[model samples]
Target chain A: MHVSAILTVIGRDRPGLTQALADVVAETGGNWGDSQLARLGGHYVGSVLVELPAGGLPALEQALRCLPDDLTVTLVEVTPEPHPPEGSRFSVSLVGQDRQGILREVTSVLAEMGVNIESLETGLEHEAWTGQKLFRADVQIFVPASLPLEVVADALEHISGEIMVDINLSEALR
Target chain B: MHVSAILTVIGRDRPGLTQALADVVAETGGNWGDSQLARLGGHYVGSVLVELPAGGLPALEQALRCLPDDLTVTLVEVTPEPHPPEGSRFSVSLVGQDRQGILREVTSVLAEMGVNIESLETGLEHEAWTGQKLFRADVQIFVPASLPLEVVADALEHISGEIMVDINLSEALR
Candidate 1:
């Protein structure tokens, strides 16, 4: 049987960190299927997906544990996924003053619309000269196309009006 | 003042989709920012981020109305967003027979852990020879360091065991 594993390496950023991870997986006969490596805030974080023979998991886990303490490892076998009976894709963006209730309010509206938010990212910006606080977010949602688009839009507009922010709902490109 | 718009276009797959989109945005004085376009089934679905002068929205809305009846358009204004608080990022993958509860069960665990999924995609696979079912999902999440890593692993394992599927969580490389 095929056994899938995902390994993450985190430690002070340094050369050879990825090599160390690759070495461990290789030693256990794990096939490195995919990985992502990036530097964030001066720290090195790496994630990899590996496929191994069912018999090789123990060796892989044991090998990973022997690595440095700064590098934490957790593993879960792959699982079955379910497909929605119906779905529609949407894009949502928000612009407003920084406040705590924003995400809750916006996501609540999405939930009521039976929308599944597939991707979301938020960021804060200060006017270079004014230092004024501004919050922004972009979210992509999957909803059923059979639903009236207007209902979703109206819900978002109502929330935007209440929060003194701008909220938009449109079809996603892809 | 700047006005942000989310625009999406979908129709029978054809070559002029991009040009049509660009023409509409250009004529409306809108700057296209982010976009995703792909063919799903026999139709081309596209989503775009655009910024325009506040006064240009009406014209853009009017111009978009000229599209074919099969095309659906949604436009909304939005506010700025702020960055998510700092945290760790992880990758999640699930594979199993296709069904519905998988998303709810898996996301519920993340929600309880204060982990935020950044992006997620799910799909189904059919065995070429046996015609059996296979479902899979890949999700990337941002997890606060304060959340116990073991707890997450356990939750995923439980879901996997119950669903007769596989769930893997690995540290994100970036």
Candidate 2:
């Protein structure tokens, strides 16, 4: 058994920030897993999944030593699901004029259907020709294998009209 | 000075393979850095960036001991460029029916212009209406701060017609 953690750090961007945290993970004999690290608004922001030997070690807390005092750090321990859910992965992509609550509205629909969002990325880009700021979101969703695909398709089709965006839903077969 | 090593491991897919290698990284007091891991054709394949102490233990190469004998592993040491190239990051996204040499053609154009590719990811996705297999590639390129963006844009425009694909070039301002 191993301990799984999602370690997040947000601070000024620099080259060695991840290395500093990774060194701490190593010193504790932990396995650093997949991560998404990016820069936002002149700040370095990232979340990493790390696996550690179950229990013991104030060492991770000591990771504070490696970072500057002002950074915001959050470490959350993830408990493995008693029974990992059975599902199929699908992709949801959105593009349209930037607006408030687009995410909330779209996700509320998914929530109603009992779908699980696996990963979500939202960004803003200029629309070609129009030069308007366009909001785009790409999401990977987990639909219970027992759920009918056509049902989700129908639901997504219904919501696109309400959300006023070009949304596409498709199976992301691995 | 820290050691940056790109370590690659490929074997039959299993859950604990990365853990085994990561344990070794921890034991050697190395820093585990950014990586991309994926399953391709029933194989567990991954490459990890690990920072090691300058020249000492044969530990990494001996990682062979922890993995099954059939697996293939390779380690490449990246020598920091004497003068790391100065640049602005732009994105190149491609979408079209599957074809050979699309990557070759696109990258060759960038190569001619002395543009450096920072990161690239390629995958097969399906076209919505046609239900045809579509090839997609997203690339982050570093255009030397000295290189005019229009020059690259003009070059990309010239090649898109020849390549028979829809390619979009945009600044991915961070």
Candidate 3:
């Protein structure tokens, strides 16, 4: 049986860093699958996914521990796992002037509706031109297949209108 | 011109939460594009993205401020920013044994390769039978079009083998 893993590595930025790390993975008989690497605050940050022979972790760990002084490696085993549930999906976003007491009222409604949130990202920015403060949030929700999309949209719209915020719903992207 | 914002509200969790927030957004004539709301640590946490008509914030703020008690709202402005230059898009992932240092090493190599990691997610699970760990990372990157995919894969593979991990590279599903 094959064992799976994901590894994340970080260190001071420099040359030969990748080659050095690759050397370890290559020698371990692991296959490199995916990655993302970037420089943040003058340091390198990377994440990757890999697979190993069922009983290869001991040897793999031994090899990783031998990394050069400047490099460090941590391995994460990837258990072949079940997937997320499937359902109808929708998204809603809201933005307005900065204040208090907004999130509580909105989320309570969704929870009551039994909506499953898939992903949510939020951020704040002050407009350079207008010098105005603004707030924003994007949320993706998984609606049960049996639910009516229009009804959900209408309910959300009612909530948005009541809150003086905007509401829109759509099928999940991707 | 319309102004857009993302709002995040977090406070002790209770009933009638989201509705209070949504009422404010709706009253402000903002369009709620998406949202995410949940409970964390006895506190209700929610985020919403809203698009408002020009000059509608003042009323929106007033409406939000009047929401039923015990909930607070903080608005954040969101920018629909474009991806950065050096214009390359790719995804990468790794699966391997759970350990420290893997993220550090892999990121170091990617930075050396001039890759920009856009988003990353990692998960770890322990095997009940063996007590071994499985690690997985999913990542998206913006690479220089000049960089060859095979070379990238080879470098990642080299590192994976050295670290005794697995890696996969592609345009998506990393």
Candidate 4:
């Protein structure tokens, strides 16, 4: 039976970084799945999903350990993901002036509500007209079946007016 | 005055792909802005926004020309991106069974209505139960002020029920 594992790697954004990782996967008889790799802060950061025979797990790790210097790798075997309670998905957006603790404040709210974040992408840019730094994020989340959609909406409504940001919350389409 | 240009590159996913580009930018006195770099189909695909002194534009392009082969690059100067008509930003998602031309059909509607796509990310996965292929995408877009949000909604409404896909559209928070 094939097992899956999550592998994350960080290194200088140089040529052959991905290929070196891919080589490990290939040599281990692993199949690389969906991966999100990008350059952040001038370094290469990536997480890959790989499936392989159970025995290949240790070999993959051993090979990763021998990869040349200056690279960091983390591998977590998914002994089968802990399937969350059946829940609804949510798509939320937050945009506002750049300030400290915005992510902390917002994520705190979601955590308080027992929501799980699935994916989040954020960016900071200068507003064209005023040159004010703008912070924006798009997040996809999962709300456990116990939470009501209206409850989430109420929570957002309560916080949106108090913050310096505009928040959009919706039951993301399935 | 500093001007901005968009640089896109595609090449084998190896070490130094991004650094090579950064080298050119640095050699020409260009400041790299935001860039999205990812691996797709076993190759590196990326687009970068860069700001550089007006004089550095030609030199930047010239240095790019001297780069080794196997890398394809496209540079476009944004004489200030044609300010789109006053409009709103939209976050749209389409998810359903994997099928050919799903992007074509959905993008056709947006294009026909003159909506400009800002960024799009998509993925395909296999359903755990039925082994069916699931396709999903998230798109960020700009709609000209001329188009009403409802018009876009209506267009989506018209298509959602006809296809095997479920779509979610919201005026992205800004």
Stretch of 10 with least lDDT, candidate 2 chain A: A35-44
The TM-score measured for candidate 2 stands at 0.51
Could you tell me the interface RMSD of model 1?
A: 16.2
Measured against the true structure, the TM-scores of the candidates, in listed sequence, are 0.49, 0.51, 0.45, 0.53
Q: Flag regions of model 2 displaced more than 4 Å.
A: B1-174
Candidate scoring better on TM-score of 3 and 4: 4
- The positional error of residue B168 in candidate 3, measured at the CA in angstroms, is 1.3
- Highest DockQ: give the candidate number: 3
**Quality class of the docking in candidate 3, CAPRI style:** incorrect
**How much is the lDDT of residue B3 in candidate 1?**
78
What are the per-model DockQ values?
A: 0.02, 0.03, 0.07, 0.03
Task: Tell me the RMSD of model 3 versus the true structure.
Answer: 12.1
Candidate 3 local lDDT, B32-125, one digit each (tens): 5544455332344544667788877667776777765445565544444444455567778887897655766776778788775565656676
lDDT of 4 by residue, A20-126 (tens): 67667777877655555555444455556677886778999999999976676766665543333688888888888865446556766776777765555566789
Model 4 C-alpha lDDT per residue in residues B107-150, reported as the tens digit of each score: 66776787765545567789999999887777667788888888
After aligning candidate 4 to the native by TM-score, how far in Å is the CA of B3 from where it should be? 26
Task: Tell me the whole-model lDDT of each prediction, alpha carbons only.
Answer: 0.63, 0.64, 0.62, 0.69
